[model samples]
Target: MTATDPRLLPFSAVLSSLENEGAYAVMAAAAAVESATGKPVIHLEIGQPAFPTPAPVADAAIAAIAAGKTKYSSPRGVAPLRAAIASLANRHRGLAVTPQHVVVGSGAKPGLFLATLALVRGPHDHLLIPDPGFPTYRAMVAVANGTAVPVPLRPDMRSFDMPALEAAVTHRTRLVVLNSPGNPTGGVVPLEHLRRIAQLAVEHDFWVVSDEIYSQLCYEDTYTSIASPPGMAVRTVVVDGFSKSYCMTGWRLGWAIMPPPLAERVELLLVHSVGCTATFTQEAGIAALAGGGEVEMLRREYRKRRDIVVKGLNAIPGVRCDRPQGAFCAFADVRSFGRSSKEIADVLLQDGLVAVLPGTDFGEQGEGFIRLSYVSEEEEQREGLRRIAATLGRLRPVKAVA
Candidate 1:
């Protein structure tokens, strides 16, 4: 018999057409180039913080390991860690989150995936997500075999389209995913918009999954949780983690807050999937909650970097970047240059030695934009901007008229 074709592997259909997160793909490309050329590549592609893990958080995890606390934990998470997450949410977001409402997991991502799987019950179920939003939102819904409908953000780039959202909701709409201090754009959804969304969810009787991982990094506006609204706590699932605020990326721990029954369902999913988040990592999360000072220092530094990157991008010719109200990214519009974002990103990487994610990879509406993460060191951030400006500056001299 002839040799079988290698392409005929038994992988799921989702794997065949997966839309990967562009940031990580760019970061990996940058790494390969840096390694091969033995030159440092300025990384503005991903949101991995430049700071080391907070000392207190690291120490707590070490102590737990030294004390032989490495065994498997409850699939729902450790008791103290769940309580800590609940308390922090209540204190910070004015939500009535109790331990009963908390479900800890390996990271916010897993909880998000589990929530989507648990909520999106059938192939006919429809899930609403923001266009040009986090790539994982739609991916998870697809993995759950649900229809993913993207609601585009307003042209102003500050808020979502309320009328579009109202029109999108129906009995088939099972879940709506929201990201505040959003990824890539760093635009926070205002309280009024959130209130309207809450009202819609109440009327349509659909669940809202709010991904508030960047809640602590808001630069201008106060952070608000949709669950805090009256009659909304029971209908919202909050996904948060220690990766951003405490710079505990390697720790791999995060949690969810929702109604007790929903939390239990998520916990059951965790039980059947991965056993639980590592026990010691949960200890580290406990320390992070206790050490508020570390998070505050990080917030202050990210705010400064945010200002620098926004200002630098705006100063460049053919580029106009708005100051992000929250998070550590600056999404710059480069449509004026009449180039796809990927082409610009390639030029920056090859000529300028700077890496950024092309926005079009996020969704259709993300075309003509590129997302730069300002989570690098201050000097590196400045140098990356300089290189970006210098390279783009050369293009303005002969740019084609639109």
Candidate 2:
């Protein structure tokens, strides 16, 4: 083998299909620019929580390690943690989820991958994922060697454009991936529309994978679960976790709950993929799930930060942001600005030392948008938004050509 050829290790064919993800690139740029400028990077890029993980959850993990629960348990995860996830959903969502229906793993991310692996019947069948939704949705579909059909949403109104979505579905459709308190756009589908999608699922005989990871991170409205919809429970696979709610990202704990039948298949796949999450982490999950006030403190703080970021973002010129009803993000339209979303992001990084993800990172339709996360301290958010205003305010708005 040639010297240069040896430098590259052989990997899955999927490696070639993996395009450079834009949001990650944006974060890299933010890091490089801030390092060069010696500026404290006001990170509004990633969706991680602003507050520390609840103390009890951290304590439980530490305690588990102390007790020598570090060994791998089961592919289906520790029974206590899996049961805790089911109980939490049933109590909070008012949907009866049983331990037999739950399968835990490293995090919502891996659980999601397992769901995709278990759901897609063949390479030819397509999965419907929302446009401008979580980039991971599309990426996961590719990793599973399946086609991803993007169902576009109207960012201006922050809801699904029903007719467009309806047209995208074909006889080859096998799964529909829906995310509430959605990423990038922060669009939450109304109950009525959710039912309509469920109805369509019944008509098409397709399985539904609803991502409720942001279930707890909402404002102005109560969180909804697709499984709560009558008759949909059997066809829907609900995925949610302790990361966003309990601020337990590093803990790497999450669960996938499906109707009992699919849960079995999911467990088989999970076994081959991760064997199991650490035993101690599962114990910590139990602590997070049982009723507590620590999680509420984080919710309260995120709500405040959302307001802090939203108000400041709205005051910026050539940029208009919709009030997000849920999630710690504001979807701002920068179409009025003379620059494209990428250009605007670059200028902000160079001028204000602020990191914001371009709308285009989520979907092509997001070209005029920028996702501004409020997952930072209040004072930092205020300063970042002010810098954004100062930088964007100087640019003249350009009129679109006829």
Candidate 3:
């Protein structure tokens, strides 16, 4: 453990950086505040679903465990689960995939990590990601020694800017990540925009890594898969999981659909890295796919909570929040207050006993905003908004003029 010891040498730069990710830092700070204050902090910082795993999935897992299914599954996952995922993707997303094209990993997060590892050859390759995007994308690219170029989301906060993407992409760009109903902003990309991006990828000969974990949570519009575009299937890797859609976060199961060869490579990566996903978890995933009604109920409930949070946030004097078309988060514009997003978020946590993530945690573009996850119960969501409104109202005298 001494500094001179070989083991004390610097760890992988990317792994070291992931330890300090803004979201995890804020969540830890929130926990500390709650502990010190002896009062429940309103948690709008984490993106986990407030609900428990659905009964069918949990039951299936328990049964599998009791039936001695504790052994290892294939790196591509159990055959039944892979077939289920393939069928679901083909039917819902209009993608033609088979079990052979599916690669299951521990979670969608790891699926993304493995995809980047398999796709990026070295530091010379570029991975184009969205600014104010899910931080994991950039972290994964870095872990694989790929240069990450962040393309800023449009000002309206609804979708990616085509012009910006066009400017960023080049022959050296190896991958473009598409997160519809994106994290932090909750802005769902339009289908036409995706088609255009798909065309651009085809022209540039870059791969597309589509994270569709939130596809089942859309409210105003149906979710569209970028892989559905003509001639894009072979070039697109669709990553999704049972966590968000089925309230199975603790289960840690996810799948990806890619061309057969790339899928094979990713499966190999999984085998070397984690060996395989847990067998019982894959069984639970099968039940989740069969029990689709649970997600529908969740979507309905989240829509109601989303409405509450958006309305409450927009009503604040210096805050303007756009109603997110999908996902369980509201990105509120707090630039009118002039304070840095971290300052505002800190004030909310310490003074208002409300914990929300600052926009800066996402990227530079998130500097003056805050992301509020409506993933808590309806009552807690309302209370969180109330605290935030009061906090912002108190700052109006000093911050409004800025």
Q: Kindly list the per-residue Cα lDDT of model 1 for residues 253-303, writing each as its tens digit.
A: 888888999888888899999988889998998988988997788888988
Go through the candidates in order and give the clash count of each. Answer: 0, 0, 0
Q: Sort by lDDT, best first: what order?
A: 3, 1, 2
Give me the overall lDDT of model 2: 0.81
Task: Tell how far residue 303 is off in model 3, in angstroms.
Answer: 0.7
Local distance difference test values of all predictions, in order? 0.87, 0.81, 0.88
In model 2, how large is the Cα lDDT of residue 212?
87
Candidate 3 has what TM-score? 0.96
Tens digits of per-residue lDDT for model 2, 142-231 = 888889888788645456688988898889988888888788767677878888888888888888888888778777677778778767
Q: Write the per-residue lDDT of candidate 3 for residues 50-158, one digit (tens) a residue.
A: 8999888899989999999999778788999999999999899988889999998888987899888999999889998988888888888878999999899998776
By summed lDDT, the worst window of 10 consecutive residues in model 1 runs over: 393-402
- Poorest 10 consecutive residues of model 3 by lDDT? 393-402
